[model samples]
Target: MALPKEYVNQMRELLGEEAEDFLASYAEPKKTAIRLNGLKIESTGFGEKEAVDKPSAGQSFVAGRDPVPWAAGAYYTDKTERPGKHPYYYAGLYYIQEPSAMLPAELLDPQPGQRVLDLCAAPGGKSTQLAAKLRGTGLLVTNDLATERTKALAKNIERAGIGCAVVTNESPAKLAAAFGATFDRVLVDAPCSGEGMFRKDEDMVRQWDADAPARYAAMQDEIMLEAAKMVAPGGRLAYSTCTFSPVENEGTIARFLAAHPDFEIVATESPAAWGFAPGRPEWLTPEEAAALGPDRTARLADTIRLWPHRVRGEGHFAALLERAAPSGMAVSGASPESEPAGAAAAESRKAGGKTGGASFKDPKPGKRTTAVRRGAEAAGRGRSKGFDDRTGGESDTIARYEAFLRESLPGWKPPGTIRIKGDHVYAVSEPAGSMQGLRLVREGWLLGLSTRHRFEPSQALAMGLKPHQAALSLQLAGESEDAIRYLKGETLQPEPAKVTGLNGEPADKRGWTLVCLDGCPLGWGRWDGATLKNELLPGWRQV
Candidate 1:
């Protein structure tokens, strides 16, 4: 495994006596890990109570775990275990991630009920982590500039049972313009030269060039500037990268600090305490250091680096940044520019009384031409009443939706406005106008579809609910034949006793049933006296 000579030389110059060990560490097996989803499980010991049904001793998905020390709920798993193939994986019990990649979101520490953003959130690992911290309490607006990557991003959000997410596919500049310092916390996990990943992915080594860092540094700086604009006053921002490049890490911070006077780097505990190394201001060239000046250069040490040789995982870098609060403002209080919680009270600037804040403006002209024009007010008021006669779909669309909720999900109300767009129904957090003019992927939580006369609940809705949340539920042992059959999209003929209703209601063996694997909601099924028809999303069905 030959590294780029230029890169080796550079590392040697920067790491000195540590360079040999750092380069040799690449030959070792890459670490594999998973972060347990808090939205899905209560604690690390969740499977212990259900241990009786195990196919064999220690057969639980989390039976034996080697936890990642720096991150709670994250554990190191071996590659041979193939955790991805487990039924629990389909149930969204955990997320497969590199241990080092988990640090940024852990450091950002988004709280419940605070609006958060993952600016470069493609493939959504960090975004999902932040959403778990929110615990279904606040809005999570995750965006990626690449139009195609958002498909996976949306799937991951839904899979994790996250209901308060708004998925967007747009440029950072456009989002900054529309949101305007509205988020309580922001994460810009900037794309880099993949220098840090060279050990884990040989492809990155093949693709490396001498100029990669400088090229990516320019983009990272620009992205940071736009991301800075979206942070609320006194809000926190985290910048991170997978590359060990000084130009992309410390250099980018130095440049950003020089430009943005209202922001400062918050000091953190000693990096070694968390199996990390402090940022190296000494790595920057003399000219680069002079450009940053003495004060900011010294402050750069507050950032952290996770080296492949020093940590149990791959290499990564992360820095916490905070925007200064206005004079006399409390850190926890909302700033004047901040959008209020629920944001339903804010009047739309659009004419003729639209809700949210603006009409859906397609980022591209002539695309989404048939986009529905309902406001958040319609979703919040008319639809929730189960009689939204205004949107002009089928006359009984809302009636059907209401009936489903009452019968299947008796006590659970979709958190946001129930907006009907075409045949699709969404429980949207912000009014349609709030995201006006941005390219939208998913408006909010996709509740289901409103067909001609019936409301078909979506796989997303099923994944987002718990077993008790539904009126009727079918619980399958994680290793039972029934579980795999259901996951394969096969119908089942179960004993009437297997079907149970919420709060002592009689199990009639009819209507929609939330299907689960070991009490973890997998999807939905409809039981018709004799057979349980699988309603699992076809795309999600195990092959």
Candidate 2:
């Protein structure tokens, strides 16, 4: 791939002698990875939020190795390992992300119970990590300017079993005005000139020009102004970018600190401590510092940058800033002492933990998992596609949903408080903002659908459940042909004697059961006499 001349020139100056080494990194294959979902894992039975070190499904899930240095529970997978094609991916066991892309969220270090926000979340890599950091204890509101992208963000969050999040499609200015220093931790993974993505996405090279960085720098300033407003006093605001441009990385931070003196750059966990380099304020000329002041340039050293040559990933930059002035918008999460891991969460990530996927243990069908058909005005279809349009939360809908829950889940209490919209039902774990006009992609835990006549659970809801949680369940072993068949949306017969069937025998009755691979719930499926119908979503099917 030919390097963009302007981009190369800019990086050449920014990197000095190291520029050659940095540019040469593009020749090496990029590192691929997945961060485990801490929230989706089993918690300590001792009534605390700490997750167990191992998965109940066993160790076959984490069969591969090479852990990322920043994101905890994240490991570099083989480049060809298309986890998206696996049942565990649909089960929300982990999120596939570029290694350097995981650094900023790790540096943010959100605790289990604090209110947080991701100012520019889309395709949800960082937001999911934030959800894992929160461990289902606090509110996390993630936003993107475009409503279309928020759909993917919402799915990734829900798929990862996060119920405390509210995904929104709105501008930073509107959110800042509405929130007003409300978050304990705020992340701005600003969109940049794609200098870092040239290798991974060749189109970025076609789009790049000398003018792109300056254009992005201007936009970053506008977005940063609003992001700063939403930071609570004493709260931390983490800013990051994938571009190597000084104008966007250092210059933008310099301008923000100068614009808001009450906000100061605080030293974040440095990958440099592990051999990566820090951000260079010296890259900015004296003229640039004139606007941000002289000290602003010196403080830039506090920020960190991940170079592709230095690390086994693409370029990325991160800066941690604290709002020193009291704005009263500060919300508290878990005390710092109780946070699960440090900014460099990799050091503390649990190693050798098992994962959920392809279960073979056929549930002993003792109880029937049938929801009674309720009479109502509209026997409608829920947002099975995941981009909700606010239609289901009526009183009748709630009642019907509860009835279904009782039948399907039995004694399992929902993780969040229930609320309905259209045919959709949600279990909200934290207090949500009014967000009246903003396009809210997801408000809480999307439990399932409840039309006038039928009630159906969601793929997202299935991922979080255990085999025992459902009234009926089918478990499969890891790497089994049956497991692959089930994930491929193929129906298969179960050995009648292996799993005790409901109503006397396997051929005697029919109902819905949670389909599992090992102990991980794949999704919902229906059984009819001799065969189990695949309920795995078409888009998510392995085949």
Q: What lDDT would each prediction earn against the true structure?
A: 0.74, 0.69
Q: What lDDT tens digits, residue by residue, belong to model 1 across residues 1-543?
A: 789899999999889999999989888889989877766664223423334654322134555666676665677898788877778888887888998898888778765566888999989899888876665665788899998898888888878888878889998899988888878789999999998787678999999999999999999999999999988887888999999899999888888987887877777664464467989888777877787678878878888899998999898999987888777765553323324312311221111121111121212211000111111111100121122324356446677788889888887767767676765678887531258888888877777766655787877888788788888988788668999999898999887878889964549647999888777788889998778998877778787
Residue lDDT tens for model 2, 1-543: 788787778678767898899888888887788777665444211111234574344334554466576656677789878888776676676788988888887777776567789989998999988876665566788889977787687777767766667778899988876778767789999989988898789899899888898899999999999998887677778899998888899989988887898887776546354456888888875767887877767889878888888887887888988777444433343555434332223222434232211111112211111111111100111145444433345776677677877766777777556666676777765543457677667666667876546566777777666666676777677667888888788987876443323332333445667877655667778776567878777755776
lDDT of 1: 0.74
How many residue-pair clashes does candidate 1 contain?
4
- lDDT (Cα, 0-100) at 310 in candidate 1: 90
TM-score of each model, paired residue for residue: 0.86, 0.84
After superposition, the stretches of candidate 1 with alpha carbons farther than 4 Å from their true spots are 43-59, 270-273, 333-394, 431-433, 504-506
